[model samples]
Structure formats: structure tokens, C-alpha cells
Target: MKGIHQSSMAVRSFVVMACVVIILAGIKTASPIVVPFVLSAFLAVICNPVITLMCRYKLPKWLAIILLMGFIVLMSLWLTSLVGSSINEFSKQMPVYRAQLVEQFAWILDKLQQFNIHISRQKVLEYFDPGMALSMTTNMLSGVGNVMANLFLIILTIVFMLLESNDLSKKAHLALDDPEMRLKQIDRFLQSVNQYMMIKTLVSIATAIIVGIGLSIIGVDYALLWAVIAFLFNYIPNIGSIIAAIPAVLLAFVQFGPAAAGVTAGLYLGTNMVMGNVIEPKFMGRGLGLSTLVVFLSLIFWGWLLGSVGMLLSVPLTMVVKIGLESSQSGMWLAILLADNVDDKLSDSSMENHKQDDTEQISEQEK
Candidate 1:
């Protein structure tokens, strides 16, 4: 009987794994539709607190939503105007930057030859093409712009989501067998996500402002554009800041020289050190409880699945999966595996606590 039970459990696990693979494949195929809706849901989550605050103060929810949407629309228009022009100007100047970068590369190759290093300039350029980097930078901006082009649809979805927020709890209660327990779990998940999103957004904005100001002071052309890039990429974990800095540093090198590039790199290094390493952690506390390897792997996996937006949303998405797993009695082991520091003892303790709570509830019902 024990062997039969074990075999049945193995079959169940295999079935679950197969289902997960199928779901992931479906999501990948439907990413174009899925990405925007997911983005909208996150934005709505960010905006919900303000609407809640206004409603608490006796303001109508509709009025609060209108005010919030109006503010967002105005800010979006203002930023689009500035960033749009910067992107255009940068596009115009790309050829000039490309030429300068090529010359700089040739000069380095010649110096290498002077030191008895006979690296072929053509091979170096072929492998690490300046034009390729520049084009990639432009493509990154273009991808963001394309998303913005669908701003109307995204905003409309957000509005609908906000309007439906109050009804969600009601619907969940009606649908779930154990409404109270499930609602508590759902609330915990939402709260965790909301706090992370808010703190991360604030940090990203601060980072962007600092980068913009520093680059402008250093006389970098398209400082605003680079700032926007920094802001967007800051959402990506581990490698985002490094990727954001590359184009800016390269431009600094081409525009001025290695000295200016060094300064540019230093500015990024200092900002990330203070903000990412210091301030963010102070406020973020233990963070999303994800292991470092899990975070990095999620970045790559989600980026591959959903493209640029996926990379931006990877950590949050993983957190959702982790928290969901944690809420399940059978899935707590997987959650522990995904967690940064959690262990089997903690998982066992958690399960014991749940069992004790159930016993207490049963006694109350009997009484």
C-alpha cells in the first residue's frame, strides 16, 4: 500500500509538471495580448492606494479615479513630448556618433599594435561593432515607444480594472469554498506586490533624476533620453544598471574621450551603489524573498518569454508565483526552494501552525 501511494504521488507530480509546461507555452504564444494586460494590472495596483485614500476621505471613487487618471495623462503627455524630441535628435546624431566611435576603436587597435599586440582592427570591429551597440540602444528606445503607442488601450484597461477593484473581493468570496482563508491569502499577496511596486517605482524615479542631472552637468547630449533609459532599465534586476550605463558611457567616450567616459561610468557606479545597495535595501527590508539565482534566471526566462517588458516585470512575476506556491499546503516545498533563506524547518513549522489553527476552528464550530 505504501508503494502504491508513492507511485500515485509520482504520477500526480508528473501531471502537474506537464500542465505547467503547457500553460507556459500558451502564455508565450499569447504574449502580445498578455503583456499589455499584465502591465495594466500592475499600473492599476500602483494607482489603487491613492484612490483608496481619496475614498476614505469621503470623496467619491469615480471622482478620485478621474483625478488620478487626469494627472497621469498630463504627466504622460509632458514626458512623451520631451523624450520624443530627444529620441529624434539622437537618431539624427547616430551616424556622427558611429563614425567617432569607429575612429576611436581604430586608434585603440593602432595603440595595441604599438605594444606588439597585433590584433586585427577589422576582426575587433566585426566582433564589437560600435554601430551595433548604437542600433541596439535605438531599438530599446523604439520598443518602449511602441508600448507607449498603445497607451490609450493600456489606460482604458487600467481604468476598468480600478473600477472593478472593489468587486473583486466580493467575487472571490462567492467563488471560493473557503472564502475567509482564501481572501486573507489574496490580500497578503496583493499587499506584498503593492509595496514592492511602490518602493521600486520611487527608487527608479530617483535613480533616473540623478542620472539625468549628472549627465546634463557632464554635457552629455540626449541626457534626458539616457535618463529615461536608466529609469526603464532600473526595473530589471542585477544587470539593468550595467546595461543602461553602456550606451551612455560609450556616447561619453565618443563625445569627449576616455576621461569623460570614466566620469560617466563613475556617476552610474556611485548612484547604483548608494541607491541600489543602500537606500533601496533599507526601505525594502528583506526584499521579495527570492534567491539570487532565481532572480537572475527569472530575468532571463521572462525576458525570453515576453521580450523587454518581460524583463522589466520578471521579479514581480516570480514573486507572484512564489507567494502562490507558499499559500498551498502541497506546494510549500517548492516555495522554500525558491526562497532566499527559508528552510524545511520553517516550512514544517508553518504547516504545524496551520494545522493548530484548523483544530481550534473545529473546536469552536463544535461548541
Candidate 2:
């Protein structure tokens, strides 16, 4: 029996590994189409509440869906405009930024010279030169394809997702509706997803605002830009905050020198700490508790597979998977995939503390 159990465990492990390899291969091949579809699915989740509200109002579901789609389109366009404007502004100020960067680099080189430490500044210049030109930055922005086409694809997918929203839950119900159970599973899944995304979005936006204001007060040039990056990257756990802080701190160093840069770094780090440590856990609790190691691995895997946007969306995608897994009869396997490592530690601590309390109570009774 023991040998059979060990063999079964080994086979399970092999199957899991094979599945992971296949999924990664698929991501590489399918990212162009898959990225937009994933975005659409998440966006659909967010707007589902409004869709339900429209249905509740006795508006024909189709018309309500139309209105909701229009609203989403307008909002997407407005955000695009804001981002485009920021890009234009950043472009105009590139020369000044370049000069500041050179100045900062020179200061560093001077210190190194004083210490007799030599490093070629030209190599460093080549590495960072992309930030100097739009043409050069094409690699960063083009990603899978051009900006215009990517935007069109994303918007187009979103439209289809909105249009198909009505039939989505129907399909799920048709597939999963059991004689023993009613709509409870589906309802719980949707409710959990809606609640989790809402809380996540709120926390991210708040972190962005606080960090942005702090950066701006410290006289960081691209305060709004860094803030937007912070807001976007906040979706990624453990690593996003650190990545966002790098540019902000580098810019601060360029503009204000050491003292101001230190202050800027402090503010960014502190804000991230408060948000990640205190505020988020308070609101999120165990709702979407992805393991930190798993979250980072997903960020790296998806980011490589899809690009920067994939990294940004990784956590939400994983959360959706977790919710689906937990809600379905045959999805217990996926539940294990999404659970946090901290959960085990938390459980152990509670059990030990409970045991200690019980011992104390017994001692008191003896006394």
C-alpha cells in the first residue's frame, strides 16, 4: 500500500510538471490574441454588477448591455487620452531629463574617481538611451505589436465580452447545474469575484494617490507618471512596488541630488509598506490570499509570455482561477494552486496558541 501511494504521488507530480510546460508553450504561441481576451474577461467581471443592475431595472438586457458597453468605451478612451497626454509631455521634457540624468551620472563618476574605482559610463549610457527617444522606446511600447492595433484589439474584445455577458452565466449554469444543487455555486463564485476585485482596485488606487502625492511633494519630475505606474503595478504582489519605486527614486536623484532622493525613496517605500502590510490585508484578509512565491512566479512567467501588461494582470488572473476552482465540484486541484503559503504558518500559529491557552486553563483548574 505504501509503495503504491508513493508511486501515485510521483505520477501526480509528473503530470503537474507536464501541464505547466504545456501551458507555458501555449502562452508563447497565443499571447497576441490571448492577452486581449484575458483583459476582456476581467473587465467583464467588473461590469457584471452594472449589467445585473440594468436587468433589475426592467430594461431589456440587450439595451442595458449596450449602455454599459458605451460607458466602458468612453471611459477607456478617456484613460487613453490621459496616458497619451502624459506621454507627449514626457517626450517634450526628454532633453531636460537626459541632461539631469547625465548630471547625476557625472556626480557618481566623480565619487568613483575619488575612490579610484573605474567603470565605463558609455556602456551605461547605451543601456539607458532608450528613454531618450520615441523611436528607441519602440521596443518597450511595441511589445507584441503597435500601440494602435493593440488598443483596437483590446477595445474590440471588450465589446464582444460585453455583448456576450448575458449568455456567460447561462453557459456555466447549463454545464454545471446539478440535480442536488441550485444556483448556489455559480452565485457564490460571482459574488466572491466581484467583492475581491472591488477591494483590490480600491486599495491599488489609494496606494497610487498616496505615493504620487508623496513623490510630487519631493519634487519628482514625472510624479503623475510614476503614480500611474504604481497604480498599475500594484496589481502585482511583492515585486511591483519595488519596480515602480526605482524610476521615481532615480528621477529624484537626478533632480534633487542625494538628500532629496533619499527622502523620495523613504516616502515611496513607506507608502508601499503601509498599503501592502496594513491596509490591503485588513480589507482583503483571506479573500484572494495568493502565496507570495506563487505570485512572483506568475508575474515572471506571464510577463515573459505576454509582456508588461501580463505582469500587471497576473494577480487578478490568478485570483479568478482560484475563485473558479473553489466554486466548482471538480476544481479542488486548482484550489491548492491558488492558496497562500502564509496560510499554513497562520494555521500553525493559531493551533499552537490555542494549545497553550488550553494548558493554562488546565493549570488554573488544578490550582
Ten-residue region with minimum lDDT total, candidate 2: 132-141
Q: Write the per-residue lDDT of candidate 2 for residues 1-367, one digit (tens) a residue.
A: 9999999999998997899799889987987677777766777777777777788989986787778777766865675566568777877876787777677688778888899988677755665542543343234334523333566566667667777776776676666654334445465566666777677678888988998788877877767767776776677677777766776676676677778879988887888788778986787676556777778888887778778667767777766666566556457556666677646735754675687699889999999
Which ranges of candidate 2 are over 4 A from the true structure? 1-27, 50-68, 88-92, 105-108, 119-170, 173-188, 320-334, 341-367
lDDT of 2 at 259: 86
Clashing pairs in 2: none
lDDT of each: 0.83, 0.70
Candidate 2 similarity to native, TM-score? 0.71
Scored by TM-score, the top model is 1
Per-model TM against the reference: 0.88, 0.71
